[model samples]
Structure formats: structure tokens, C-alpha cells
Target: MRNKPPYALSSVDHALHLAALLQQEGPMRVTDAAERLGVAVSTAHRLLAMLVYRDFAEQGPDRRYRPGKVLRPAAASAAPVALLRELCLPELRTLMERTQESANLMVPAGAEVRFIATAESPQVLRGGDRVGRSLPAHCVSGGKTILAALPPTELDALYSEDDSVDLPRLRRELALVRERGFAINDQLTETGLTAVGMAIKDAGGSPVAALSLALPTARFDRERLPGWVGALSSAVAKVEAALSAR
Candidate 1:
């Protein structure tokens, strides 16, 4: 039998319990979750909201919470992910310092991308830390950058399985990304947020992750895009070199 820690945090325990419920029991209403967890409805809502934000749970069309992608079984191991974050954080911090914008490191997860680390900008109006967040691959700058680096057959196979994706349109955008050697997401992932991204290649020239600079759309001057791309390229180079050395 597993023993609970003496100093167990009630909030954390509640959230984990909620995640277990969602993963094992499938979708549930807020009221039902509150009853099952023996917490107030408002507390349950807050807990579910946190889960949604972390990609552990998602609210469905019927307003019921269901297990999200993070809860699904995956072949990827956590060790490499942790190492990737460790290797790239310094560069992310440097990029943030140089660009004065939030820098993020992300890796593709099927049709979506997961932000593993972030160096939040010190600016008053800037994108906040988004670690653990997941977004559609075809929508975000980093996602597109990584996708563009994918082999043609792999890219085609990936999008072919998803009916919702417009493969042709995505291919056209990716063509532009390939031509420019960078991708730009202009208020595509979130309103008022824009990001520039470049791929981080491994020793064999395969892209394993992407780096992005996210900022408020209002401050995303096209004239500054070249500078942002240059910063991201520099950060990616450092991260790639570290990965290669490792």
C-alpha cells in the first residue's frame, strides 16, 4: 500500500485525485467532480481549470472535463525531455535577455506541440510563462518550424491521418517557412500574441525541437522580425550544439 506523506498538501492531493478521476473514469461534470472529491463546486471548478491549463484535462463540447493529451500513453521518455529543457534553458534565457521578449522551447507531440520551458520577458506587456501548455501544430510558430523540418513523407503521413487538418494549406505555409528559414505566428495561437520560431536540429540534422520568441502582437513590428529570427537562430544553434555534444 502506498502511504501519503505526513506533510501532504491538500490542494495538490485534490488536483491529483481529480486527474486520476478524469483519466480513469472519463468525462465528468463540474458538479459531479465536486461531489466525488468532497470539495465545493467552486473549488472543483478551479481545480479543473488548473488541469485544463496544464493539458492534463480538457473541457468538452458538453462542458464536461475529460483526460487531455498529457494523460494519454506515449512512446517518448521523460529523461530526454528533462535534458532538453536543461540544455535549452540557458539559451532561452539569453534570447529573452537579448530580445526583451519571452522565449520558449517546444517539441512536437503528434498534431500538437508542447512548451517545455520558457524565459518570461521582464516587459510589463509580454507573453507570460507558458511551460506545459499545448497547442495545435499547424497554428503556432514553433510548431510550424518543426513541422517544416520534418521529412516530406513523415509530414505527409502525420497530416494524412487527421481529417480536420487542411494539408494543402499547411503545406503552402510550410513552404513559406522553408523559404524564409523561420516561421511567424501572428495572433494565431492566442489573440494579441505573436511568435517567431526556428528549428533546433540534432547531430544528424534532424529537428528535435523548436525555439520561439513570443511577444504582444501590438509590439510585433515586422521591421524587427529579422532581429527576432536572428536571436532565435542563435539560441537554436547553442541548444543544438549542446544536444550534439551530449
Candidate 2:
């Protein structure tokens, strides 16, 4: 019988290395994995597919891959989630105290935003924003901050041809956000609730999450929105810096 090629052994080694890297790092793309492994694109793609099939990794809507539940048992548990909580809690508390509004730390999950952590205000009319709640990505301030950070090509791919072709308007709005360093949703997600948000970029300047403050429209004065925006922006900067420094 013919001897098995050395490439097969190399492929197995590369896949194991990639899996270990994903467990250590956060989410990444196939190209990123290939670059890190110094392997061909096709090889990385195959490895990722196998990992996904075996439930060792999960693919996000943006095509990035993250470690799946199957890998959680062997890996150190609770550290990643605890790190997120520890980093976000103080900022969320500050935002709540400053604005007297609900504050949240949201991350992209598939096509929606998931509230990883939240701090509720003591106001009588506070909106109850709970953790683990998922919301449409296009309809919330936090979601908009994340969506606006995506490249034009990725943004275009997000919307369908039959859907509202409002690319020009969207681009203009995002440009304004780029200038202002934040995003706003005026009763977009729910009636009488307005939110202001800032994106949280990782060390590489990629938007990994967003932070936002939500208040009732009755108390959302246009004149006072700037102050809230500033508060949220400051909180976001501090959190991003802390995360990047780690």
C-alpha cells in the first residue's frame, strides 16, 4: 500500500493548533486562522468546517468563528464571562448613576445584539432592561454603533436587495456618528425609550461590543442628550482602554 502523505499529519497538527488558538483568543475568521497557522486558505477553511461540524466551534453571522459549548468543558470555565462582567460593571454603574438611566453592555450574536450585562437606574419610571435579552441589530443604539463600524461591503451584504435600499442615507448617518463618536436611537427599539451608544473596539480597532444608556422619552430632553452622550462616550473609552490593555 502507498504511504500516507505528510500533508495529512500537518493538517491534523494545524487543526489542533487552530482550535487551541481560538480557545485562547476570542472570535476570528478563517483567513485570520490561516495567516496565524501559515497554511493555505483551503486548509484553514476545511479545518474550520470540521471543527464546526464536531461542535468544537460555532460560526457567527459575520462569518467569524468562536469556541462552542463542546470545547467549554475542557477549557477553563467562567474566566471569559467573569472578565466581561468585571470590566463592564463599574462603567455600567457609573452611567446609571450619571444619567439615572438603564445602561447595558451588548455584544453581537448572529444577526442580533445580546445584552451581556445591565445596570438599572433607581428612577421610578425606569425601563426594565434585562440581561440575555436579544434585540434586532438595526433597531437599537448599541446595535447601530456596531453596525456603523462595519465596512461598506459588509454593510451592503447585511441588507437584502428587496429590502429598503437606504444605503446612501445609512452611510450619511454613520458618517455623522463617526464624527460625533457615538450613536442615538430615538424611540427606535421601544416606544418612549431613547438610547445613546458608543462602540467598544478591541486592541486592533475592531468593534467587538457596544455600551449604551437608555432613558424614557419623557425625560429625554434634546438639550440634555449631549451630556448623556458624553457620559456614555467616556465610559466606553475607559472600558475599551482597559480591555485593550489586558
Candidate 3:
């Protein structure tokens, strides 16, 4: 038979490829979708944005895109802990590599945040691993990020009748977090430990998790604050992407 060239529209092909991914996976980020389709981030972003506009896909609070009502989710499911731990380990590793600091994943439990995964830095003076530990959600960076993503009524309920916390002050802090898009802990949880974090959301757009970087006070450079925030944000995005796959 005579040879014939295959017909393809690159843009449409990429969009259909992304739709297939959304059907097979749960959610995905622009970077991930771009890498998967071998395209630029801007191209992938535009495609996903168009999908959102057409109601073929939806963007979650974490800024990841998932299959919209036009598509059905995969049926596979796993225990929450198992799925979370698996999803976060690589993200924590990525955060550690980016910041050379301890990286931790946390999930909210009522008024507390439980450490679900931890990747500690190699430096001798680095912050310790906090896996399997729990702390008040309103105190640490990760926990505060999660709390700040909550509804006003839920937040008010969380702090009501708590004598140890200054509700007004906490509210102001959360307001600042929403404005800044990330949370910071300047030795608030521990005397010499500092951290920055961003909230992680599920396909439904609820802040179910947080990704954070823990740094020793002496090594936490204020000049590099923006870089650190970027790392944390990237980590959360990757985590959301991975979670979608599961």
C-alpha cells in the first residue's frame, strides 16, 4: 500500500490527551499536563483554562484541573492514609531538594494537624522529622494554611471558647495568608524553627492537606522567602497532581 501521512491537529490532540488523563486520573496541574503532553506550560494552561470555560474540566482550589461533569471519575480508591502517604512522599522529597530543608505533609484532624509524611534535610543543624506527630492547627505554618482555607463559619467554630488562642489575632493572620497565597511560621511553633507552607486541596476543592518546609531559624534566610514560598507552592501542586492519579 502507498504510504499516507497521518492527520492531526496538535492543539486538539493535546486537549483530547488531557481529557483522557482527566478521565484516567483524578486531577492534574499545568506543569504536569504540559510535561505529559510534551508542550509548554503556557500551552497546557491555556488548554485547561478553555476546558474549564467549556465545563469539560474544572479547576480546584489547589489550581489543579480535574474532569468536569462531562467526564466520569475512575472508580479506583484506596484508604485515605495509604493514598496520602504515597502521594506525599515524592512531593516531600521534591520540597527537600528545592529548599534543602525538612519537608512535611499534614492533614487536619478537627483542631489539630497530623503529620502524615516527613522528609528531613541532610544538614546536621536541620529541623527534625515530624512524622506521626500532631499539633494545634492554628499554630504551625502547614496547619494554619489548612485552617485559613476553611470557611469563616468553620474557622469560627474551631476557635470558639478556646482561651489559649487570640481569635481576633488569628483571624487577622489568616486574612493575611489569603492575601499572600502562602502561610509563614516565624518561630511561632518552636523557638528556633521556621516554616512556610501552602494548602493542598482534593478534586472537590477542599483543603484536605498542606505541604511545608521546615528550616532552622539561623538558616531561614528572609531574603529567600519568595523562593521558599515558590518551592512550597510547587510541591503542593505536584502533590495534588499525584493524588489525582490515585
Clashes of each: 0, 0, 1
lDDT by residue for model 2 (183-204), tens: 8888877898888888887787
- Please report how far candidate 3 places residue 25 from its true position, in Å: 50
Query: Model 2 — TM-score against the truth?
Result: 0.64
lDDT of 3 at 227: 92
lDDT of 3: 0.82
> How well does candidate 3 match the true structure, expressed as C-alpha RMSD?
17.6
Q: When superposed on Cα atoms, how far off is each prediction in RMSD?
A: 2.3, 14.1, 17.6
Error of 3 at 69 (Å): 43
**Which window of ten consecutive residues has the lowest lDDT sum in model 1?**
72-81
Stretches of candidate 1 off by over 4 Å are 60-64, 72-79
C-alpha TM-score for every candidate: 0.89, 0.64, 0.66
How would you encode candidate 1's per-residue C-alpha lDDT over 50-141 as one tens digit per residue? Answer: 99988899999999999987787643522258888899989999999999999998887776788889999999999988887778878999
- Which residue runs of candidate 3 sit more than 4 Å off their true CA positions? 1-79
Candidate 1, residue 169: CA error in Å? 2.7
Candidate 3 lDDT over 114-172, as tens digits, reads 77788999999998877656567788888888888889998989788898999999999
* Alpha-carbon lDDT, every model: 0.88, 0.79, 0.82
* Highest lDDT model number: 1
